[model samples]
Target: MENHLYDGLIRYIIKKTRLDKGLQQRDLADLHISDGTISNVERGKVVVRDDTFNYLLNKLGLDGGKLNELVKKEKEFIEHLKFRLDCIESMLNNGYLELANEELKLIHLDEFHPLAPFLMYLKGRYIYKKKE
Candidate 1:
């Protein structure tokens, strides 16, 4: 989900700021946020609401510029991945198995990337067909 990307970016920034400021998760307790919520947010396991996000940022004494930049980078990464996936799909459709396989190798997806499962499926299909 694109929302996850945005939330993940914000969460990462918040976590980084916390570390840089030497603030522990418990330090935010006065904000009335639970430890589980803080942990989930730090791990990017959940999306934080806008108001709560702003409150967290304010508490961290961080400017929004870093968050904005991270969000922009996230969007750019998604667009680039879409382009690569389209190229791979096209190569496969044209029966250029080798070319598709080469393109798949160039994908450079992170282990926890959202498209990892789809990429795995494509890779398995490619491998299965290659050996046939």
Candidate 2:
């Protein structure tokens, strides 16, 4: 993906990574970068230097290269995820298990979210319904 592809997702990924690592804002504070700056970056209010971005990722032991692509894909994934959830719920409610299962298969779970487990629940429900 191109650098322009970030489209503010860089902020989202970095911020989420920070949270997942159990590190607080102040924990990532450096001599030059403060917790407030980190907050701004995560909120998309500011863009830090490229080296700083890499350093932050390195601090969390995350690979920056692949992360960029993953974040890019996440943007698309989240959009579809929202709509798919509604469709899946409606299908399941209407006893259209097979159609719901097919729709679920089209979504890629490259990015992590609680929706993953919910999706699995839907799959199991589909199988259970088919068995009955």
Name the candidate that leads on TM-score.
1
Q: Candidate 1: list runs displaced more than 4 Å.
A: 1-35, 42-62
lDDT by residue for model 1 over 57-90, one digit each (tens)?
6677755775677668777877778788877877
Candidate 2 lands at a TM-score of 0.53
Q: Judge candidate 2 against the unseen true structure and give its global Cα lDDT, from 0 to 1.
A: 0.71
How many clashing pairs per prediction, in order? 0, 0
* Candidate 2 lDDT by residue in tens digits, 1-132: 222213555666776778878899999898967888677666656666766666666776767567867776887877778778878978988998878888978876524353567777777877888888
Q: After superposition, how far is residue 45 of candidate 1 from its true place, in Å?
A: 6.0
What is the C-alpha local distance difference test score of each model?
0.70, 0.71
Which residue pairs collide in model 2, if any?
A: none
